[model samples]
Target: MYAVIRVRGRTGIKKNIADNLNMLNLTRISHATVIPETPSYDGMLQKGKDYITWGEISEDTLKELISVRGRLPGDKRVTDEYVKENTDYDSVDALATAIFNQETTMKDAGLKPIFRLNPPRKGYEGTKKPYTEGGSLGYRSENINELIEKMI
Candidate 1:
């Protein structure tokens, strides 16, 4: 049973975490993080002044992480019909949990709650499928490759 927590942050006080936590659903941070220096993209670059932004989370990297994990072993979230169908990948938190609750876990990386779904036998089997005969070992071995690929 995955605990689904609804997240609501402030663009007012929490604007710094806007991107990283945007897709997640958590009302409050399990823990708080603070840092001094914010990295500037213009530093050492032959360019004009730009917003020296810094905090956790990046859209490109996050997408890459999810895609990478989806293709790796032990990560079966890729097979999630819920994820595959949706054009926009929601945060890995309860937002996705409402779709298929195969035991989700909450992650506190910022003010937002990120989530990763627990793979069914190492992947998604849609929530309705006779993928195995009462969850047997032989049944799993027979579908192991499918399970691995689908999890991505």
Candidate 2:
């Protein structure tokens, strides 16, 4: 799965970019959502790259995210038993492994589409440039999980 995060605030954003962000469910700054790596998602990410950062997430990070942010239909937190009862997985780690393997998505496991992350504890370098230049926008590859950890 891929993790798409809103790096910049919403203001003066073009209509198309805004639309893509809305579709991705990243409607607020510091918000994130896990998405499957499909062609449609790739296009949306590309179109909104200037305002967001995305990349593959690690199993460890995925587990923490699910434990801390995963919510049920009625806005209840997911427990191990809930995961076992609702999905095929016996535990969160098993579910997380499947997500990393692209065998399942957050939606499949009953997670909320959006993750309201805390701003990175130490703050981001900046949000204007690409990740290659030490800014927060654009893709960060597997390192995206590291950034997510700081925010979590």
Candidate 3:
């Protein structure tokens, strides 16, 4: 799965990008959402590329994210036994693997689709430019996990 994090806010954003962000369910700063890796999602990410950063999420990071930020229905924390009883997966990693493979989504696992995160402790270099330009937008591949860790 891919993790998409909103880098910028909703001021001065164009209509199309705003709509794309809404479809991605990222209306707040420091919010994140996991989506399957597919052509449709690829286009959505690109549509909001200027306002977000995305990348392939690692299994370890997925586990950490779920343990720390994942919330069940009614805002409960996700526990190992809860995952086992509520879903077929035995562990967070297994569920993450399944989601990574597009067998299930965050919804299927009984977890909240949106992850509310803290702004990176050190702050971003710039939200106006791409990752390759020493900024915080666009794709960062495995480095996205590093960013998530800081925010978590």
Q: Least accurate stretch of 10 residues (summed lDDT) in model 1?
A: 44-53
Q: CA lDDT of 131 in candidate 3?
A: 99
User: What TM-score would every model get versus the actual structure?
Assistant: 0.19, 0.91, 0.93
Highest TM-score: which candidate? 3
User: Best by lDDT, which number?
Assistant: 3
Ranked candidates, highest lDDT first: 3, 2, 1
Q: For every candidate structure, what is the RMSD over all alpha carbons to the true structure, in angstroms?
A: 19.4, 1.5, 1.3
Candidate 3 — worst ten consecutive residues by lDDT sum?
Answer: 92-101
User: Please, what are the lDDT tens digits per residue for candidate 2 over residues 1-152?
Assistant: 89888989889999988988999999999999888889988988989999999999877898899788777788898888998999999998888788778798778778787888999988988989999998989989998998999998
Cα distance off (Å), candidate 1, residue 31: 17
For 41-116, candidate 1 gives per-residue lDDT tens digits of 2121112101111123322333333444422234345434444354233543333333233232223211123323
Taking all chains together, the TM-score of candidate 3 against the true structure is 0.93
Q: Can you give the lDDT of residue 127 in candidate 2?
A: 87
* Regions more than 4 Å wrong, model 3: none
Candidate 1 is scored at a TM of: 0.19
- 2 or 3, greater by TM-score: 3
Q: Choose 1 or 2, whichever is better by TM-score.
A: 2
